[model samples]
Target chain A: MESNRTESRENRYLNPYLGGVLLGLVVIAAFYTSGRGPGATGALKGLIVTGVEAVVPEAAASSGFVAEYREPLPGHPLRSWLVFQMMGLITGGFLSGAFAGRLKFRIEHNYRITSERRLLMALGGGILFGFGSQLGRGCTSGAALSGMSVLSLGGFITMVSIFGTAFALAWFFRKNWI
Target chain B: MGPLVIYEVISENINLLTAFIIGTAFGWVLESSGFSSSRKLAGVFYGYDMVVLKVFFTAAVTGMLGLLFMSLFGWIDLSLVYVNPTFLTSAIAGGVVMGAGFIMGGFCPGTSFSAAAIGKIDAMVFIVGLFIGIGLFGAGYSIWQELYLAADMGHLKISDSLGMSDGLFALLLILAASAIFYFAEMVERKFASHRL
Candidate 1:
């Protein structure tokens, strides 16, 4: 009975169009002030570079790959603007969940799949996404969405490719999601 | 008179703070839109729900229009806004891999963070995997350097490349988006019974 009530509350999310409007406004504000789009993967990348530097200073410094991240101009790599923004994302997400009574600790998977399978797939997916974001110079939010907003041709291409590839492979991963 | 940061109206410190504020709104909107739910996100593929399409295109078009009006009014310098460079090869290749990941993981980096915020264990695992993958990429950067840098066309805009006015492109985009929204609604209604 208690679970059902929580589920009901979870269903009370904002209308998709309204949510999109709010999100777009945020992007606009970001462009107007920061002169850049909001980013997620960049923060994660910074953290990874910082972690490597902390554990093996020589390895991090020796690599021409991590050279830019070795010392982010203004301050510590971990203290980059994206890092703080990500922190705020966590905070805001939690607040929204809490307010909407949607905060639940559970694994979400289709009934056809086991929790274990779901987790493994998630891990594999994350790795692919991480690697791909680095290659593409951004992920969905950063490169594609933000890029498209500014009429960037690359952004449109990335957006189409991402969705096109997903659609092509959706059937194969049907069990995992649906 | 706009893009306040570019005009030096706000200090860098304050700009960073504003980033946090903007991110808060971004996260809040995403979560409230049900993006934190993997099933919902993946629903776009199966046609059970097209929330992702609806929200994404709506948001993109809205932002695009906002920038257009802002620039027309001379409130913001559109050129000053950063554009992701056109790296043709890597863009397509990376998008392909990310698409596969999207299907398997059911959450993109941003959405996963939101899911993790709500104590989703799968999202947490995905986050850990992201760190590891990035670490590996850093280690193997030499192998990827060439492919990553292939076909760099610099900051090219779609409107410019297609030889159409920006205003015309935006109008076409709005029409396309509206059509997608209409189709999405119809698909959802038809497939509402299908489980995802």
Candidate 2:
């Protein structure tokens, strides 16, 4: 009974449309002030570049992919706009979780799957997403959301492709999710 | 006049500060909307929950309309905003991979960060994989360079490609979104019993 109450409480969330409007306003705010949309993969890429540069400066300097981020900028890669935004994202997420009493160290997965299997799947998925984000030049947020806001054809294409592929493959992965 | 940073109305430091503030808002909204839960996120693919569809489409339409109105009011110059460039082969290929990732992982990059912040161990592991994946890409740049840079169609706009005014496209999009929302609601009700 105690667990049931907590489960119900945790399930409570903002209305979908309201959440979307707030998210939209935030997107508009990002563009209005910075002339760029919010991004997650870009920030992660910065972190990756920073890590690579710190461990092997020469490798970073020599590699074409890594070198692009090493522009003769005065500040560290972590000090860039996206990185700062990402930090705030963590902070904000934490705050929201705390307020909702949902902050807990746990592995979320379906009852049908073991925690170990879920974690493995998560890691594999992350690798694919990370690699794909680079190839596509952006992730869902940067390429799709931001792109669609500007009516960019690339954004629409990416959006359609991502959703289409996911839908088509959903049946195969039903065990993992359903 | 807007996009204050682009017009030099705001300094660089201020812009970074703005990014943090905007990100905070984004995170808050996402978490409050239940995006921090992998199970909830995955439900969209299974027709169990339509929150993702509703939230995503609404947000896109809202942002599109906001930009159009802002431009109409002369509050901002739309041209100054960054439009994602099209690399046909890479975009399609990358998206397909990401789609598979979404099915397996149940969270996108942004959503994963929020989930991790909320103390989801799976999310943390996923992030580690992301770093490794990105590292692999950087290390093998030569192998993927050809495909990544291929078929570059510079900053094309959907409206221009369709030969319609931005306003007209926006209107059609709004209509399409409404229809989708209605369908989503029906599906959600049908699958209510399957919800986790």
Candidate 3:
């Protein structure tokens, strides 16, 4: 009975509404302090750009994408605020998982699928997301949430397209998640 | 006077530190809400779990209201806050692509980070793919530059576009959100027995 109770407690998560409130406050804090909302892809983009610059300085310097990113920087590309924020995200996530007893190195997948298949899907999904986010100028955090908060039209459009497409395609991918 | 770092009320270094602190709080809340589980995250699409919809809308509304109130109280300069620019073609196209990614991957960029933090190996693979995807995008920027920059409507507000007051639009959103929450609950119940 004791072990069962402990297991239940370990699996429990915070109430959804409460989590939303906390997340909102975090966004507000971000805006008030930095004049911008939270962003995840930008940080990743920064890392990618930094890697390219390190590996091929001439190529990176000549590229329009890399040039745009590097033009505004006075220091190393990796020394961006978004990069720091992403590091914080990692640290915070680890701490939370550790505290919640949820930190375990494992692959999560549908019962019917193998771990290898799941990883492949994940890789394919990530590639699509990364490419799309670059074109979209933001991901869920930067575009959808922050944009919606400010009542941006583009934000609304992006949100609709994203969720709508997902719903439309969810049926096809049902085997993966369901 | 708001956006302290932008106004130079705080040093750049301190602002960066704040980013880290805020990110920590963001990650903690996301993970605490079970976003670390891709299955749970995907449940929003399957209707077995509505946590994502509930949390996302609630947070957006809360932040919107908070920003409005703060600006009214003269505690912050809402005008200074960045609003994402609207590029019609790119937004829709990109979002469609992202949607496909979300269902297949069962996570978004932010949620994936939190999920990976909890030691999800799939999330790790997703991150590696993200790096490569981005690298490819940069390399091929020339081919899609036109579409990416097309139909630019600079920082347009939905409320303004609709001729509604910001406060009024926000109010309507909250009301709509409540209705959606009710519907979400019903859907969850219907699917609960089936185990989607």
Candidate 3 or 1, higher DockQ: 3
Model 1 Cα lDDT, one tens digit per residue, B14-120 = 98898898889888888889988899999999999899999999999999999999999999999888988999999999899889889889989999999999888
lDDT of each: 0.88, 0.89, 0.89
Q: Considering the two chains of model 1, state its CAPRI-style docking category.
A: high
- Off-target runs (Cα >4 Å) in candidate 2 are A1-3, A70-74
Which digits, one per residue and each the tens of the lDDT, describe model 1 over residues A1-178?
9988977888787899988888889889889998888778999988777788789998888886678565434368876667778888888899898899889899988999999999999999999888888888889999888999899888899888889999999999998876
Candidate 2 structure quality by residue, lDDT tens digits, B1-196: 8899989999989999988999998888889899998889888889998888899999999999999999999999999999988899999998998888888888888889989999999999888878877777888999999999999999999999999999999999999999999999999999999987
TM accuracy, model 2: 0.97
Runs in model 1 with CA error above 4 Å? A1-3, A70-74
Q: Is candidate 1 or candidate 2 better by DockQ?
A: 2
TM-score of each: 0.97, 0.97, 0.97
Interface RMSD of each: 0.9, 0.8, 0.8
Scoring only the second chain, what is candidate 1's TM-score?
A: 0.97
Q: Which stretches of candidate 3 lie over 4 Å from their true place?
A: A1-3, B194-196
TM-score of the A-chain for all models: 0.93, 0.94, 0.94
Candidate 2 residue lDDT tens string, A60-127 = 88888876666634478877878878888888888898888899999999989999999999999899
**For model 3, which pairs clash?**
none
